[model samples]
Target: MKTHRLVQNFSGYRALICALPERSTEALAPTLKKLGLQSELIGHSPAAPVVLPFENINADRDILFIDGDMTLPMDWRCLRGAGRSALPPAPVVGLVGIEAPSRLKALLLLGATAFLAKPVYGGAVYSALFLGVNEYNRKEILVDAVDVLYEKRRRRAVVIKAVVSLMNIRNIDEDVAYDLLRKESMRARLSIEDYCEYMLGLRQEQDKNENAHGERQALKG
Candidate 1:
């Protein structure tokens, strides 16, 4: 079954060109408008692109046109880059210069899904936007899958500890303990891993109280 919905036409889509508000943006704007996308220019300082607030940007519809002339905002550590296992908050198109290794690397780190040459042209806008948006969507799917697998692997040992603790405390067999935990997890509206962690904490507190009570009785005797 085909589940994915493709973004066919750009109607009411918003784009931000992250660079100096110069002639390039002036040329780019009218082309974007014709395509039914609202475009704006975003200028970054000589220092970094951190001043370009990512929080204001939308993940699905926003597109970034990052100029390769200056350094990217490393301060935006949460920003996804080219080689990362995750996608950036939005798709990015790089505006290139002489194409030096360092300059290209900066664009890669900003997670530029597509590239557009300097002296932006009207003909190239639709193609760049098409590639950038689609490529980013593909990467996001793969990244999300990897994250789910990693979390499951990390919690495997915790699952064992939780199961063993349940068996000992409840004086039940391993299978029974696991089933009980599973049922309780459903009741609590939690994942099995989360419920197990919660149970473990309760077990620790119960042990402390029992030990304290035993000591009090012994002292009195």
Candidate 2:
């Protein structure tokens, strides 16, 4: 539900250019410098597979310019972080030399949010950076929302358990129990599931204490 503001300026961002030495990347570095981005040219060979610095990539500070003309037999799974989303660690702008579907598909698989045509022009660099960064931001927002949904789903069972427990204890209906939980959760400034989990934990501790006390009393008797 949160709206992300579009990133217009790319100041202090690092552009990681992964292309062969023979590729026409001359304009890229200088253009990026004008936009306040530090450029690092990653050397790649046409005969050998491209090795991307997957671990070193930071979504906030790094943008990738990948050469689509070259073949990269990389394990796409490495791009995923702890959340296991297929998104790249940073914004990706594919360098398109070949207009073929196969080449484009490779870029897509690399999670290219924007594209730069072959023979990088200074005119297009800004646009590519803007689009790539903003698109990545949008995807990140969506991924965060998905993560929240998954967490809420996982805690649904806990909510149910709490509702049933409250109903049985207070001799109330399910609706009343649930409403009580919602009110309490609001007062506690926690999600319904989170409040329920906390309440259940407290009840568990109370039950343990009572059981221990009873055992001691019986032993003394």
Candidate 3:
């Protein structure tokens, strides 16, 4: 009833699940049906970012969650009231079990509202989803400077164009890219936004060096 009530106002509301075999998906059947949400199964691998079909996530029925291997780029508390405002902010019910304080702080800075640990039960799942929906419905949507900073930093045209041109293109968002980079870097806890800023700085430095080299060559000529 809670899920239905939440979805009733939205058109074609759906939930996509990226779950592991170890964690059976059968338990989510009832919740899916109650919410009229579509479900999909993805193999569990830490190497993969939780891949939800973005086409399914739009203005209509836009609420979404990346249930596995999702690490935040900043403190999620900064994202309070994101969904209701004109900016994008759907509630994220994260599942972080015994995470490091640094990891938790990063998630909080990114504005995550709830933490649903692993080995979840029916009640815990229900509570997190229902409460997220309730909070979403009650608030005014608004994204802050930090969110904007993340968005702008993450979606550079050159990077997006490069990604778009790639035959194996995955998520184009920079936050997604940053997370992947951190995963590959073997860092303990790197916020996507923070990681992006560092990478961007590196790129700028490279460009500056190239420009200086060009100037030197012209002088030699």
- The number of the candidate with the highest lDDT is 2
Candidate 2 backbone clash number: 0
lDDT of 2 by residue, 129-154 (tens): 99999998998889889988999999
Candidate ranking under lDDT, highest first, comes to 2, 1, 3
User: Which of 1 and 2 is ahead in lDDT?
Assistant: 2
Query: lDDT tens string, model 1, 118-173?
Result: 67888988888888888877777777778788898899787789989878877898
The full ranking of all candidates by TM-score, starting with the best, is 2, 1, 3
Against the correct fold, how does model 2 do in TM-score? 0.89
Candidate 2: regions farther than 4 A off: 1-3, 44-49, 72-76, 82-84
Q: What is the C-alpha lDDT of each candidate?
A: 0.78, 0.87, 0.51
Q: Output the lDDT of residue 84, model 3.
A: 36
Of the candidates shown, which would achieve the greatest TM-score relative to the real structure? Answer: 2
